[model samples]
Target: MKDRKSARTKETIVRAARKIFSEHAYHTASIRMIGKEAGIEHPLINYYFPSKAELFDAIIREICEEFAASAGEWFDAIREREITEGFTEFIELLMEFNRHNPEPLRILALNLTQTKDFSLIPGYHRFPDLISRLHTLYVEKIKPMGPDQEIRMFLHSFYFLIISFLGAGPCIAQVQGMDPDGEPYREWMKATLLFIFLPRLKDINLPRAAAREDG
Candidate 1:
């Protein structure tokens, strides 16, 4: 009973921290604000977390767990369907999650920019292995003519695609002439993914002009 109670308290603190951090960004969010939001005294957060940085790490870990759960669900869905469709479904699921969970996504982006202290986050450690697994999955699905080279290039291209979308939010808004905080932002993200991945561009044979024009 004690352990369960502690677990619940920790969860409440983490959730409150997430909300505060998401709204204010990591640099601006204060432990006092998180405590107030959680309905706990500020000192209690120190008792539970020991330090503000530790609390931030805990919240990031929770976010990572959410990400892992979403990825597992996508993989489970893929296992039940054709393997070729897995990539499309996975991308769509991610876009949908980002569209809905903009807060967490915003927090993650801020953390990436401002912090190097992600040791407590589970998925942070497994990043390399995760990338390898994703690469293998793509290679297995696409089976491009030059399978090995194509997989490498595809991974690189996809990396750039994701980085551009998430990291260049302001630039993306400028290009589309839409407010970064508006609904069009999400639509642009979805359309960008579809434009890059859905057509199986690897299989298409066309001159640079035609490819560029169509793309």
Candidate 2:
């Protein structure tokens, strides 16, 4: 009973923190605010989390673990497939994931871009491995133009773009006079990825390393 109570208390804190942090970026959010939102004393929050930074990190770690459990298989399958197929599947999965879990992504997108010290996110350490897999997919499977540097930049840009797009998708849709939840918009995004983005990627001039490998 004690453990169950503790678990509920912790979850309540996290849920309150998630809501507060999402509404106000990390730096702007205070433990007092979180405690008030959670209906607990500020000291109780400190008892559960040493600092605001630690609390923030806990939320990110929780989000990453949950995302991994849900989407890990899709990433694994991407490693097994051809680059085009993998990339298409990845984009589709991202759209679906965002559609279902908008809150976490919104929290992440806001905090990540606003913060300079990325060490706040405990899951950040795993990012290198993630990028490494993408590098292999590009170099070994697609063999896209340019060297690893170019591929790294491409991947970074895409990651930011996708996250930002999903985070601000509704606002963007409104601005563009489109419905974010509409099937037509989703289909347009699918076609844009395949016909436009993929085609443009194909146009990048091959670096000497790639050209030599081809030769």
Candidate 3:
């Protein structure tokens, strides 16, 4: 069943490798396993990527580019709305993004979140660009709220909680005796996140011009 001559061998390999990496994480996944999952000869992988680390970087870049494009669209879509309306829409868009792109979330959990040093991946260099793209969208939350210690704490909470939700939401749902894939839990999570975050958005004044300028 190994068809090495496929015209899209590189793409095939990437798809297969993504599955393996997302399932196994970086340390446990091997190129040989990727090749087997790819139904490709091991040497053929070298033609596309110099090494496993480079391939991992390639995947990270792919995900970063994908997210950057999505975040831009999300930012534009929310620009005209009132603050609460925009924040609500943004959260739904993020949930939809996670639903559609669960693989990226899973891969992130596997490779990044479990470790104290998230820079464990060789592709850490691309993180600044990724953060820049996200930060652009993130400013919507920060702008009206202002970048205080509370806002910083909110960012940390958002990252840790959202990632945890995405990674283990089903198990948590099950523990609560809810259907993991049912609408109930999905709605519950959205409502829960809003409950946690919306209070911060309520009644917050934008920083004064003087304070903004000083910072």
Which candidate number would show the highest TM-score if scored against the true structure?
3
lDDT of 2 by residue, 116-147 (tens): 67666544555555545555655664446655
Off by over 4 Å in 3: 1-7, 140-145, 148-152, 203-215
Q: Rank the candidates by TM-score, best first.
A: 3, 2, 1
Lowest-scoring 10 consecutive residues by lDDT in candidate 1?
A: 201-210
User: Which has the greatest lDDT?
Assistant: 3
The 0-to-1 C-alpha lDDT of every candidate, in the order given, reads 0.64, 0.70, 0.73
Candidate 2: regions farther than 4 A off: 36-39, 67-71, 78-85, 112-147, 200-215
The residue-by-residue lDDT of candidate 1 on 1-215, one tens digit each, is 99999889988998888778867756678889999999999998888999887887667666656765676666666543433355567666776776677555666555555556655432344444545665565445433344466556666577546645754566678787987657788677767776776555433212322544576
Residue 2, candidate 1: alpha-carbon lDDT:
96
Better candidate number, 2 or 3, judged by lDDT? 3
* Number of the candidate with higher TM-score, 1 or 3: 3
TM-score of 2: 0.70
Error of 1 at 52 (Å): 1.8
Q: What are the clash counts of all predictions, listed in order?
A: 0, 0, 0
Between the candidate structures 2 and 3, which one is better when assessed by TM-score?
3
